[model samples]
Target: MKRALVIGASQSLGSHLATRLASNGWQVVGTGRRPASEVPGSEGFAYERLDLSDPEEAHRFLEGAGSDAYDLVVHNAVTYGAIPGKPPALDELEAMFRVNALVPYRLLHGVLAAQPTDRFCSCVVVNSDSIYHATKQSAPYAATKAALRVLTTSLADTFRSAQVSVATLLLGPLPDPRKLADFQRVAERHDVPVEDVKRAFLRKANPFYVIDDLIGFDACYRSVEYLAGLGPAGNGMVCRLDGGSAGSLI
Candidate 1:
């Protein structure tokens, strides 16, 4: 029974992944701002409140947890919006950069350094295709995920000796309340039914299952398991979640 740490376990997507892993016999430790007594499939799993926005706080917390040699580390915690009220572009950029890039960039080394050489472990950095799009509502957010993608790849190079793996899960439309509500509010204000917005975001344009589906997490776990079994060093792989599940979107 290997241990796994998830930084954004409160998110629907993270919660789904954590539960799946726990059901499969992994010791799931989840961190989030609002710690639930328990979530689906995580009966006795550990839950902690973590505000990783403060990099130093995150560093200290990780250093103190003492599960340094865990089998898997998922750096999926992230802040998606611009500063409250959608601050000036520069200010928003500053905040997003820290949450999306700098913290994980440095923490990867600390977490990896804590791990042992014998186990085949990997880190998955969840990303958004917003990084590849133009004039995204949250360009800074996109930039940060892109940065993580680059960092994950570079970190893989360093893990050659320890045989650890690093990967980027370029995620698409998330089906969580946060994003769906965002769509709902905007659609309502503009005199459009929320269903229309949902259709575009998930059914046609994106055509993928949202974060709550957990299918992507299943794929993620399998990919890591496979990568870890190999002797380290493999090309980065890209996976899409919803392709034909478009009918399930609305």
Candidate 2:
């Protein structure tokens, strides 16, 4: 009766992971803006419709999502808020950091505080490194994720004794021929359908394409999963996925 909690389960990747977890025998608890309208098929699971952007709601949901404990916490929720529609007074960049970095940080801490056991809880988070160093436009979103990676590693180092684990899913590029031909190489390397990989991109249509690279996602998921399985001690680990052209973590 393992229970898993997933944040931002409305997206394709999040929804897919929810279904995948349910099929693998874990009872799933998820959150979204419109659980009733966008709720993923139960597949023998449950969901709550709430905006994780609301810190209080996010904290409350994480505090008691499952049977007083979560075997795994897959944090797939994020926000770029980098769109050009807002005014400077609105502090869009700050807001991006709040959701992309701050909220997730507080949620993790809250989760730890509420746990009955002193042990570290297993966690998986979604992020983008290519956005940080790879490109310049996504500075706000990229910096937050980059900082989060460091924090996750630090947690891994600080909490290994308790057996809690946290890992980041760092993504690369998608298989959009218009962008680059190397997408197919990456898709084949990870064994994920081309479409499944497309969700990583940020575009206005289809899977969208704001994300700079999707090719390295499979490798990212695998390496993070491996580190998480190793418990909190796996934190300081600098695992990376090079996609098709690279050999190993260098």
Candidate 3:
């Protein structure tokens, strides 16, 4: 069986991907900051608690036994630093960068180091289409993703001789129900209508909002599966799964 490790598999997209991969016969191991019992879809695969914000914890997990026994590794964990109307605090920005960019770099470096040079492994970093455009609300978040993209490219080049393939999957806004619920809670906290909060959230989240532009979990799974199947051929590929919402200027 093909083994895969999915980081941050507690979130909506990550949960869906992990479940799908398990259903498709992959021996999947998923990591999340939350405990397995607290995660909704925890039964689909083996679960590990990994706090990406803590460097020492992440380092220990990476160096643990059987860390390099995977054909695919997907870095799906991310932290948003958008404070709306103003930039995030310096400390918050640093935290966001650590989770979004540095964690993946460390995770991949540790995994690759343990793998045999002759073995093949595929790594996918989930990024955002926000890196392709400018926006005040999510500027800090976008900056971190941009840094991740560049880091993926550098890793791909550096690990070419080891038969390790790295790809960045740039996704647009996804119609995750959890986001709407979170927005509703925010509205309640501020004594605003849910619809109004929803509108504002969507406006900020989907800057290039064309009808039917939101990418689905299935589409993302297929993209990742295809990239993983490519082995060495898909190294350094930046696959944009945004349904063309990030339009070309050229």
Candidate 4:
């Protein structure tokens, strides 16, 4: 049986990916900020508590998780918010970078250290198109994700001969219910109608929004599965699933 570890499996796209993997007959282990009781119907897979904001705890979790020798690992955890026209505070910036950039860097190293010398492991990082197309007031979040994309690319080279592969699945918007609240909040803060927000989002220049037709959770799940299915040496390559809009990555 193929075993996989999914980082940040608590909500949004992460939660969707975890459930899909479990249903597909994979022994899936996932991480969240709290215990499994917080997740509804978590019986299909196992859970590990992880708080990426705490560096020491994150390292420990990655080390322990790596020792399990998972065939695949999917990283989908992120923390960020946007307040237009204002710079983020130092603490918030630090937290965003830690989760988006630093954690993934350490995760790769820890997993590599723990795996058997000859075993192959595939890693997929869910990345945003924000790196190529920055949105209003999302500088900190965009910068960190850009760092993660670069870091994932660099690690692929470091592990080339170790039979390990790492790939970045650059993604666009999906119809996640949770993000409705975020859209509402941003709209309220900006004192604009929600339609204005939606209009701005329809612009292919924005990183988070895609065409309405391609905005579903299933597309994201299938994209991730396809990335994980690629053979070795597919490492460092980028696969974009941003609803057919190249978003300048092409």
Candidate 5:
């Protein structure tokens, strides 16, 4: 069976992708900051505790994983620091940068180094659509994502000769319960109506509002699978999975 490694598989999109990959007969190893006991729906795959915020922990994990090669690797871990409107401290920004971009670079470097001479590897980096549009509140988060995109492109170029392909999936907002709850909390804190906050979020995510519903996990899975299946031909590709929101303005 082909082996796949999913970084940040504790919850939300990461968990869904891990489960789906296992169901498809792939031997999957998933990493998350949460303990295995705390993570739900982790029956089919192996879970490892990986906290990307600490440089020492991240370096240790990379060092240990340097010899283990995976046919498919997905970097899905991210941290959005300080919630919007609040300026993040220097340490917070550093942590966010590490989790959002730097850790991924190290992880991919180790994985690609261990790839077998004759084996092919497909690597997917999950980014956000916020990179295209600017938001004062989310400017810091968007900067990290933009940095990730540049790193992914460079990786694609550097590893092309080694039979390793890298692609970036620029995803839009999804209906994650956790994020919805966060919005509610923010609205309450700011003394604004929850519905107004939701409406504002939707409008910002998709100015055209062409699609009534947010993008689902199934769609994201399909996009990732499709890109992986493309092999080396999809190298350096940046795919937008934002339900046509980014291009609607064109």
Candidate 6:
């Protein structure tokens, strides 16, 4: 069986992706902040605890996972928050950037530097269109993604000689129940009506939204599987999956 490493496989898209890959015959190893039992559908895969904010923990986790054991690595871990007034504190900024931007770089460097001559590896970084079109509330999140996009492109060039393919998938907002619940919680915390938050989301997301622009879990799984199947052909490719809106290769 082909070995695959999936970062941030505890919940949401990551959880779904891990489960799907396992069902399809990939020997999957997943990482998450929560315990293995807390993560749904983790029976057939290995789960490691990783808290990106804790440098020591993060380092040890990656070190143990190694760099070249897996044929594919999918980075889906993320930290999200929106500040209302002034920019986030230095510590907050650093942590978010470390998780979203730096971690992916580390994974790439490790994989490309150690891959065996006879094997090929593919690295996929889950990105957001917010990197291109940012809203007021998405500054920190968008900045991290924008930085990651450039890092991925640069690394793709650097690793081509090693027969390692690196790609960025710019994904649009998916209609997830947990995400909607988080939005509701945010609205409650700010003392704003839920409808207000919903409206803001609709307006900010309109430019990139399709008529029915909700991305489902299956679509995400298919996209990653397709990219992984590309083997040596998709080196340095950047693709966008914005549901019904627009899909392209950049």
Judged by TM-score, which candidate is best? 5
Q: What is the C-alpha RMSD of each candidate to the true structure, in Å?
A: 5.3, 7.5, 3.4, 3.7, 3.0, 4.0
Q: Please state the error at residue 235 of candidate 6 in Å.
A: 1.5
Better of 1 and 6 by lDDT: 6
Task: Give the per-residue lDDT of model 1 (tens digit) for 1-250.
Answer: 8888877777577787787778778897877776475454445567777676676677786676534667777777888764544544776677667767877777776777778777767676676666665243555666777787787777876775675777666656556767777887979888898777766665434433443332345565565455434434543444434343323535
Q: Report the alpha-carbon TM-score of model 5 versus the true structure.
A: 0.89
Residue-pair clashes per prediction, in order, are 1, 14, 0, 0, 0, 0
Per-model lDDT: 0.66, 0.60, 0.83, 0.77, 0.85, 0.79
Could you tell me the C-alpha RMSD of candidate 2 in Å?
Answer: 7.5
> Looking at candidate 5, what is the lDDT of residue 148?
91
| C-alpha TM-score for every candidate | 0.76, 0.70, 0.87, 0.85, 0.89, 0.85
Please list all clashing residue pairs in model 1, or write none if there are none: 208-242
RMSD of 3: 3.4
TM-score of 1: 0.76
lDDT at position 164, candidate 1: 73
Candidate 5 per-residue C-alpha lDDT over 95-121 given as tens digits, one digit per residue, 9 for 90 to 100:
889889988887787778778978888
lDDT of 3 at 223: 96
For candidate 4, the 10 contiguous residues with the lowest summed lDDT are 205-214
Which has the better TM-score: candidate 2, or candidate 3?
3
Give candidate 6's TM-score.
0.85
lDDT of 2 by residue, 144-209 (tens): 777777666665555555546666666544332334444456678999776555544334221223
Find the 10 residues in a row with the least total lDDT in model 6.
Answer: 241-250
lDDT of 3 by residue, 1-250 (tens): 9888899898789999899999999988899898898876779889999888899888889877337588888989988765667778888899999999988897877887677666688999998988877577877888999999898899999887777899988988776776767877899999998777766765666655553434789999999999998989889998888745577553
